[model samples]
Target: MDKVGETVLEIDLEALAHNYNYLKSKLLPKTKFLAVVKAFAYGSDMVAIAKKMESLGVDYFAVAYVREGVLLREAGIVTPILVLHPQPVNFEQLITYQLEPSLYSPKILVEFLKTAREKKLKNYPVHIKFNTGLNRLGFWETDVDYISKQLDNRDEIKITAILSHLAASEDPDEKEFSDTQIKIFKKISVALNERLGYSPFRHMLNTSGIINYPEAQFEMVRSGIGLYGYGNSAIEDKNLKPVAQLKTIISQIHKIEPGETVGYNRAFSSEGYRTTATLPLGHADGIGRQYGNGKGYVHIKGKKAPIIGNVCMDMIMVDVTEIDCVEGDEVLVFGQDNSADAFASSAQTISYEILTAISQRIKRIIR
Candidate 1:
């Protein structure tokens, strides 16, 4: 492939491996690891990242939709993929590719069983997601008995695991709430297992949960952002290496006079003579308009270049008066020198949103 045009996401496979081993060290020796490769593995290449994780010995892989799993399967990924939020329409394809579904509700369980029966497939592996307070998806604690009773006689679908999402695992102020979630998850799993006369893998830890609630590692843990780098805390972040870096080049440079405006709506007018650079990327590439008007910045020659005007659809003007930069100078959007977390904080968002929001149109290169 040609050298990437304007911007590219450089994916460091070694950094990815470092993060995996870092998180794995937090788990008990026998606990299993599931790399959450959903959202294109946090906006890195899904096939490539999944391939690396598979080679690194991840016990399983997970994706938010069935299509993501299908993509990996098509790329020859043989790891057990758990579809976190599978729609009923794709259940057939899910089974055909041996991709497991996180059956969270009565509708899903019943429909999956029905689908399995229709296809004459037996012992199809499926996971159950419980609503342990996140209340986002999954069966509620009160629904455990119902789930057990419904699956008691059905041999067509096999329950391979029971899992839950932590509501506020990273927030230290919500430790009590997180503890309650863990307790509720344990109770539901134990009750459901006793009633069903068998046990499956039971886990309830996310990236933050693995760090904040290690004792509750259960039989396995699912990691997402941490695998890509940000640990949601300064202390944890120090030990992890970011896997992706967004880079671009200064396409053009302009000298603005006092009272001269830069971009749309004249959002940034120069108070005095100022040097500015235009980068060939804008809100359309996942850098939202909210980052305009000096709210965000980029690194030019290791110096800060603040966004000056309203971020345009395909370009952004940044004040580079302090930096002696020219067209074609390298710009670091976020990576080793500029933290994605800090950049998102400037936009009043989180790192996950910024990282995953990166436009898929950007080329990804794995090192």
Candidate 2:
């Protein structure tokens, strides 16, 4: 924690490597891996995480926008990056940066093809996202024939892989639906390969897919939250190592007499004399007000301090009467000792939302 600010996210590169190795072990021998490093690598410093992944021999990277890919390229990342949802306007920049675009719909395909011709590109790598059941993005099942017709004798845009999204691969109750989605993806891949006269790589499994449907992990699989120490399962969740530890120091301590109030709107009134510690993190720092009023708890001296009153933009009050602590003492907001999953559950949210919602302003210290 040397040179760390008032509040910081300590990213353990060893834990990240452990999670990557753990997940990679679940795949077959020849299965390639694509790490989703979008949204600043789930709010854990994208450039740092990407560099680590590159060092670990990751096959590909996925980002939501072309600008993210461009930034990675500018940072000297030579690994192939897939822009999952690139707009037509960014097609030229994608080609210029050598970023592969996932052309899902007809419009994207046509516009990208036009851009390729205009840029005098040939055999540019691209991925086709087919809508198996998620229906969020990608070509529908009916668009298979249309896609083949559009790509007839077109060598400028070469299809490198076919991929799809899994709606609920981790839920046991939705296992049947996930299987159906896999079936649809397989059917589409077969039709596509027959029409194109050559089979390209096919991948449909994401993080949960790798854990739940390893048998269907075609040629490659993508890992996202799992690499950040979440598996959406009780068993695997216990095995993965949490990468980020969110911590802050107690800024000040207040001795409140009975009936005294704290924070805005007098949301908390001390029934009895209480000792409280004010932290430097607040809603602006991604600790939402929903976690206030005793919903979320922080760790101090191995004891839990429930939050009091409404969380402010720059401060939060926690009842520390039971814990032995002092001003400037380190407090665990969420991490190895205080699980983000448990903290998020108190706020009625998932760990993903809590982790990604951490503000980018907070410095990330990699260990």
Candidate 3:
């Protein structure tokens, strides 16, 4: 817990363990847990986070691309990984790494089958994704018959699970819609099981779905943000601990007089004498331009200092007129005390966007 000398993202493994256990507690005893480690584990050191989760006995891991899965494998991760949105070009590499692909479309399925057959593989594990309501990826419920036809006599791939995503599992107003999506998924699962003459495990719940709808736990549950310490609701957020804390040091202090401006294009003109502190992180560091001009604030010595003027590519100035902090003082961008959700809310965004938008250049300190 030493003060940060430079911009760094402190990752707390203990907090991660707490979040993982909290989310797992919501599932049934027999249900499996799949931890999503894509986007660099929500921008907090993917290999480190995956290694921690693997040690915690995670049943499976999911990534958005085949390269992510390969990275985990190279990092010595042996857990089965599902490439959520794999492309046909990576089929060979995906198979080489023993990474399972979620075949959502007919074209992808056929292409992957061709690759598997060409390799003379038998019963390669794969997951079938259905479009319950997300509309982003996955096969439609009506496509089950087509899927069955494609795999009719082919034994190159085996269906390990059938899964879908919930569009609005966190919104109370969308309860009916979420329920309907679950029903459709159940229908599709039954039909696919009957067609294949075998039942693959089924899963549809994301973090919020796990919180709001326990009845639809199916046979496995997937958690991404929840394991990263967000529950999509205030009530549940309290039970989880934020695993990443973005911290930096004040690079310099400025004294602004009336009519004086700050940052590029003179975005802010001081109305009165004020003090400002420049931080060594900005748009290039994942603090987007939208957070400029009083839209975002940082915590300096427990006081909120509103950001002023345009955010620079490598620096941002925050008004610290009322604070007693000076150069080299540690500044908190977001942490357990000031959650990422609260920080993102100041600029009309969500925790997921800000958390995942963090740049890889920032140093990560694992505790």
Candidate 4:
């Protein structure tokens, strides 16, 4: 794509497809692929990503909430959607949209069953989430009996899948913990299957799990960041391409004399003759305050222009003294060349946070 004239996020559908195919290649033929498109597809366009993945024949799509699922359904997405953290208040809407819920607690399970029965539904699909080690949102291993008793004779809902989250599949030091989580998940799955008189499809692998622990890939695997680019490791990242490239044009140029302040609170006082460029995106645009005061930098004309002031609500000033750049020159905030991972690392954060933090107001140019 050419230089972006304004602050925009370029979504490369081809890159997305490449990442999807690469990750899919690691799975067994029968292992279902569930693309986690939650958080607006990690701050990219969710509907667009889902449409692409669906066209790629993904078996399932997971979203964080019922409304996200509703959006996909409204967009004519026919694939099965699993809501990872559904609320009881929206259980009716979830059922209306034919979105499955991950029932992690007894209260949620009972509430959803009540709603399912109220709708006069039969065998409505729902996933049971077990807290193997994540300890976030899921039932304990001992909850298997409770879940089975709750659904013993009820035809309102059916446990179609059992799921769990890995706390640190990306960290090599957490291998033992991840293994324990997987073991616990297997034990829980066995107990639940025996109690339910049938085996629900099991899945407990995220993007990194698919890369590091393919042996534990039970029946299905879910990936979010992997689809968007960063593979949680330098090695795996080379195999996948980033789908979003954030770019903007320099709004203005400034010649700062020595000791002159650059932005709010006099955060950056020029030490020497400096040339700076103002960008039209800041905290409001997802470039947070933490990236300000020379911590983060933007790539301009193949050179690094370090941000030199407190990131404002709608703008940021970068020291462009060494670059041969003028006003309106396209700047690379993060992209295939600079990489969101490297940019985020400057602020001591991860690529996932930076990518998802991108504001929805930015124009998304789909390539």
Name the candidate that leads on lDDT: 3
RMSD values for the candidates in order, in angstroms, are: 1.7, 1.2, 0.7, 0.8
Model 3 lDDT on a 0 to 1 scale: 0.94
- Model 2, 117-144: lDDT tens digits are 8888888999999998897999998898
lDDT of each: 0.91, 0.91, 0.94, 0.93
Can you list the residue pairs that collide in candidate 1? Answer: none
Instruction: Report how far residue 27 has shifted in candidate 3, in Å.
Output: 1.0
Estimate the TM-score of every prediction. Answer: 0.98, 0.98, 0.99, 0.99
Q: What is the lDDT of residue 232 in candidate 4?
A: 91
State how far residue 249 of model 2 sits from its true place (Å).
0.3
Predicted candidate 4 versus true structure: per-residue lDDT over 1-367, tens digit per residue = 4977899999999999999999989999999999999999999999999999999999999999999999999999999999999999999999989999999998999899899988999999999999988879999988888999999889988999999989999999999999999999999988888888999999899999999999989999999999999899999989989999999999999999998998999999888999989999999999999999989999998989999889999999998888999998999999899889999999999999999999999999899
Report the candidate with higher TM-score, 2 versus 3.
Answer: 3
Ranking of all candidate structures by their lDDT, best first: 3, 4, 2, 1
lDDT of 1 by residue, 49-161 (tens): 99999999999999999999999999999989999999999998998898999998899888988999999887888899999888799888899889878877778988889
